[model samples]
Target: MVGIVIVSHSSKIAEGVKEVALQMAKNHPVYTAGGTADGGIGTDPVRIQEAIEAANTGDGVVVLADLGSAVMSVGLAKEMIDPALAKSVKLANAPLVEGAIAATVEASMGSPLAKVLQTAHDARNMDKVE
Candidate 1:
């Protein structure tokens, strides 16, 4: 089972998404990195790196970001991860809500990080089209 990392500007957002994802797939691992519930930004490179490290402990890791800053933060953290694990890290393009669902579903299916990211992206696109 691939693990998941939800990164957002707000920790509440990340936590909310993680909760929903967990509800969808009880056994999957869903870690979060982002701003705190008090609205404090949670874009620390070290924290992001830790979250990625935790997610990577499983088969692979899928990272979903809420915005550009989250993306840059995760990208920076990716550089700090082990080469083998970093190679498996991927960015999910699905929106906060849909991406969480897609990622959870894909992770539960034992999908590779790339495929999970693609599924999330596709789901986001589909949502946009609908």
Candidate 2:
């Protein structure tokens, strides 16, 4: 099954999203990469890289980041990890919370990495008013 990583400037946000995603896919792997080394609000490439490593399980990993800087952090994190493993990671341009939950559900179903990333991206187009 594809795994997931939540990246956020605030550790609480990442952890909270991970918690919610886990609710939908209890058995799916959902890791968090949030805050700085000092426990402040910021993104850490090392943390993100570690999370990506833990999330990957041979299938792939879908990363959902909160902001632009967080995305950049993920990029740096990818460079820090093994090239082969980095090749299996995809960053989803989708809403953090919704995307995480959606991706988690899709991955829990044993969906491919592409499908998981697509499901998370599709969450951005969802209409809440419907």
- Candidate that scores best on lDDT: 2
| Candidate 1 lDDT by residue in tens digits, 70-93 | 788888888988888888788777
Candidate 2 off by > 4 Å: none
> Which residue segments of model 1 deviate by more than 4 Å?
36-39, 128-130
Q: Identify the candidate with maximal TM-score.
A: 2
Residue pairs that clash (backbone atoms under 3 angstroms), model 2: none
lDDT of 2 by residue, 1-130 (tens): 8989999999999999999999888988999998998999999999999999999899999999999999999999999999999999999999999999999999999999999999999999989995
How many angstroms is residue 25 displaced in model 2 relative to the true structure, after the best TM-score fit?
0.8
Lowest lDDT 10-residue stretch of candidate 1 = 121-130
**Backbone clash tally (model 2):** 0
lDDT score of residue 128 within candidate 1 = 48
Candidate 2, residue 7: the lDDT equals: 98
